[model samples]
Target: MTTTDVHVFFLLLCLFSPKVAAHGRIPTTLDGPFSPRTRRFDPSLRLGSDDVPMDDPKLAKKVGFNFPEQIALAISFSHTSMWVSWVTGDAQIGKNVMPLDPSTVGSEVWYGEESGKYSFVQNGTAMVYNQLYPFEGLLNYTSGIIHHVRLDGLKPGTRYYYKCGDSSLKAMSKEHTFETFPTSPDHFLRKIAVVGDLGLTLNSTSTIDHLSKNDPSLILMVGDLSYANQYLTTGGKGVPCYGCAFPDAPIRETYQPRWDGWGRFMEPLTSKIPMMVIEGNHEIEPQARGINFSSYLTRFAVPSLESHSESNFYYSFNAGGIHFIMLGAYIDYNQTGAQYAWLKKDLLKVDRELPPGLWQLGILLGDGGNIEQIDIEHADDPGKCPSKNPSIPEFGGICHLNFSSGPAKGKFCWDQQPEWSAFRESSFGHGILEVINSTYALWTWHRNQDAYKESSKGDQIYIVRQPEICLANIAKVSSKDQ
Candidate 1:
């Protein structure tokens, strides 16, 4: 063959050669400690945005008694099932209030593919919670009947229309729709929005509106859900702090109905997509005999038991190729505590082989009270964390502790950033995880100020997992047992 013929053959080879595939790439811990390139907060995005008032028509219960209000969805332990929850009946607030028996209303869900055709029926459980303030000038509250039903055997990535209510009372909700997460770990999920300290403010409305349009497959709410504690009574006035201005007040107060309003506002997005929440300090609304977190514990359903977590304060779940571990800063997290023990075990159970994807672990920290000095002492050592606690009382709780060991041993503040904290930012914002492939995923944190555009990313990284690294550890353990 002539030289021209050889050149033609080489061109053919270049045109037909298979494209090189990008696979697993592991990142070193040293590759980070990345300082988020800072951008000045836009004057337009001030914290002055007020909370949407309860009387807003959008929050009012549109349907009659037994009709579903505050409708939302949450994932169960696995992709084969999901949970649907809603509230019914009129919540009452007054000096002499009557609690509605949960049994007074039937708990049921009617769902199927075809609209207006719910041939499939599922029955579930219901309950009511009360927030009592046995003090003069303080009002009492009994919630509407809340319903929770788990729908199982669902085909992932499939859409199913659903309506929940009491068939007997003809109190069914208007048809609502939701799509399941992708069944296969390899399948790509467009976006997963994450946020923390999301109070029900006008700014929050913008955040939710933008997030809804982004159309995430999942939502991870890291806590401080509603600022219900910033009120005087169940149906009374809104105050920034219960007794800050009135130090001698006889009772701590809360506007419990704000929670209902938050739920209703969130229904537009949460009803269609699953939202997984972890407690934040704002959730600890102390009332009656020092009872706390009553509204938070009752309002949302989490996969605590399903994930082997004895309490809802912390848990773990999987979405597509990602394994998410939600930790509770308000709970006991000492290396020797129950939550810490559970966390260590839970981390050990992560299986990177089946999915062959990068494992991402996330921790959300911040609340109004002093984090246990024990954890902080370790966190604040000159060789550990070199930062002081910027404590704010708006958030509640007293779980922060000083480190018992490490360079910061016995100190109350870290001299620098703690090693375990891969990244830290104080501004209120949310995060999103986009799985690009089996061994690689992209994570981004969008500050509330940057919600409109992607210009400012508070933190972003490509999390990579080396199966070889984790598998070797597993193998070593197996051999040691032998």
Candidate 2:
């Protein structure tokens, strides 16, 4: 799709805990549906920035041959278990590339409650993926061995030190530590960092730096991890608009190494904090023979099997008392699809008493300072609505339609800001979710520009849950798993 044909916008809906008190009385959702608020795009800052070079110290490989790099953590279906993933060896990209054999190296993790005291051992699986473009001039790419190990039979709300690598080769990594989420929902869930469309750019560094300062316990990455598709296989300079640069290319070209760079760049934070990710459009790196999402599928390990999910694109897990259901926007979400069936089954199993209440709310997050130009125009804005036939999706049908009911009934665009949009801005930033109690959660947004001011927040709100009013509806859905 051409640049003009695709206008991308990142949407994030997350719950967070309150770190600092608001300037004044914090508005809660119980205050009724508030009026729409809009923050006009800032003109001082450029709409976009260049991606961070692969040679940058943060992205460059720091590990030795056959050593673990890009180490990261992910949560399993329960608090008693967690997933550890890392990459070994070097990725190759050229006209003729050779793929690495995962079996050559072992996947193991050594962990214990105290530092330097080995108590438990776990062995997991390893894998590799290739991005090949057989067409002339396009280079092929093969990845390093990716390993994932799940550690089970662990206590909750406790700290554990660990190291990952192949012990046989004497290539064990340095020590790392992470605390498990509290088993009870009544316990306060610390900071949960939520970001979307986070590309590797100067702005991304700022975003991540500010996020790390908050010391979040868990991270919810709302897709669009790396904008690799904006680059060609040769990987010189990346473009903001893919179609504008190489319009005649046989297929969409991507620098697969960008994935490795992103993993290394994020290793500092992801190595200690569990990051749960759902696939975004950029991850669909299509290659020869109709292959797609090869890098995304093989690199990071999600709790798909533990959650009974058939695909890695979507899954669900619990952090404290909160059950997070991560949905895949690019996948089939129709009521007749497998995803819908899974959603139905999962929702039916929700025990309100475990978390006190299941209040349905939505929060959309974007503007995470990616290389792509910031999305300023809204569908409701004048001359911005989708045409009769919008750009067709890679896998789905033309589903865009005019509002059947609402202020813009029968029209594709609304003259004013839609009522559903509580607030909108074009600045690059990240959000933090804090669950204060069973009935309340504080949501705060931090702009990258105001990184120095810890007290400053772009937006803040309290999400109050009213079980008395919503419990009746929840009782209707009986648990099928029971």
Candidate 3:
């Protein structure tokens, strides 16, 4: 869609640890519903930035056919097991592109706690995929061998050095290291950064660099990973508005090579820290015969079957005592859908649920008359509260409902700001959630423009949970497998 047709916003929500680092006390959620507070958008921080070129050094391929690149990690249900993925061989793009034989390359990983020492070895599967555009004049693309290996029976909160590639070809990747999440339920993972709508651009580089400086143990990517779909079937310079740029093209054309470039661009950070990702609309690269999600599905691995969700679109995983449910926004989230059904069961089984990035953080509220305008309206703003047909649904159900017991009971709109809205802002920013314990979590919102200007926060507060009040609602289920 054109830029005007598609007004998307990024919401960077970071889930952090309380004991990690803090300098002040904060308020809790028990202080009653907060009044609506708004921070106007800062004119200084440009909402848009230039995309990095495909040939940029960071996105350039650094390895040959036999060697592995894009080394990354994912949690396999628990810390006891992990999944490692990488790519080999050169991706081909042209009118006629042949797919690579994944079996030709052996997928293997060697790891140990100590450097230069070997204590464990694992062999995994590999495969290649293609994104074909059969329409005349459009280009077709084929991917390199993508590999995923699962390493199980490991200790948590421990560091492990490893290498992945075709061991037989002597083209294994150089040794890289990653640490497991904290093992104890009481212990928590510190410094998690969240981001979204991360196209391979100068802005994306800045965001990544900023996140790296924060030294996050894990990353929660909210979606719209790489905007490769923004380009045309015949690769050329990208435009900010896709629909306007290629008004005549058949379906949205994506430069598949951009995916490879993005993989390389993110390798450094991903290879070191475990990143959990859910799909965004951009991942749905529709191709021949209604096929889709080829790149997203084949490139990364998530704990779907492990979490018993059985679908990569949505799943739940635990990090110590905190359980994270990565929901695919592109998926059907209605009450009747399978995703909703799975979510119902998952939430019921939460032994302990503590709630929680910055990246992919897009606009939270855009101008009215579109899906992006669906926002948490301030009840006090006179004439601003929509009456009839107030809400609109995008890829999901219409969930607008009246509060049955709150101050706005029996009314679709409140006369004033809602107590639950402690604060709001129209600026581009990222938020960090620090869970102190089962009772309190600190949340701080950082504006993009003020990132380096003395650590000024646009919004900061503590979310205190009331166990006594909601204890009866807490459900218990078997955690034998989790």
Task: Give me candidate 3's TM-score against the actual structure.
Answer: 0.81
Residue-by-residue lDDT tens digits, candidate 1, 237-322: 54444455456556557778888888888888889889988776667777777787888788888888887998888887766545
lDDT string for model 3 (6-98, tens) is 223222222333443355655555665666666544455554556677778998889887899888898787768888999999999889999
State each model's CA lDDT, in order.
Answer: 0.66, 0.80, 0.69
Best by lDDT: 2
**Superior by TM-score: candidate 1 or candidate 2:** 2
C-alpha TM-scores of all predictions: 0.78, 0.91, 0.81
Tens digit of per-residue lDDT, candidate 2, span 1-482: 00111212222212233334444688888886878877776677653667899999999999898899999999998889999999999999998988899999999999999999979999999999999999999999999999999999989999999999999999999999999988653465678888887889888888899999999988988877888888899995887767767778889889989989999999999999999888877788889999998988998889999989998888888777567887887778876799878877776566522434564644466556677757767766667775776433444467667779988898767878878777777777788887776567788988876645767888888887776777665565434323
Model 1: how far residue 124 lies from native, Å: 0.4
Sort every candidate by TM-score, greatest first.
2, 3, 1
List candidate 3 stretches off by more than 4 Å.
1-22, 352-421, 426-429, 451-454, 468-482
CA error at residue 185 for candidate 2, angstroms: 4.7
The global Cα lDDT (0 to 1) of model 3 is 0.69
Clashing pairs in 2: 11-365, 12-363, 12-364, 12-365, 13-363, 15-433, 16-433, 16-434, 17-433, 17-434
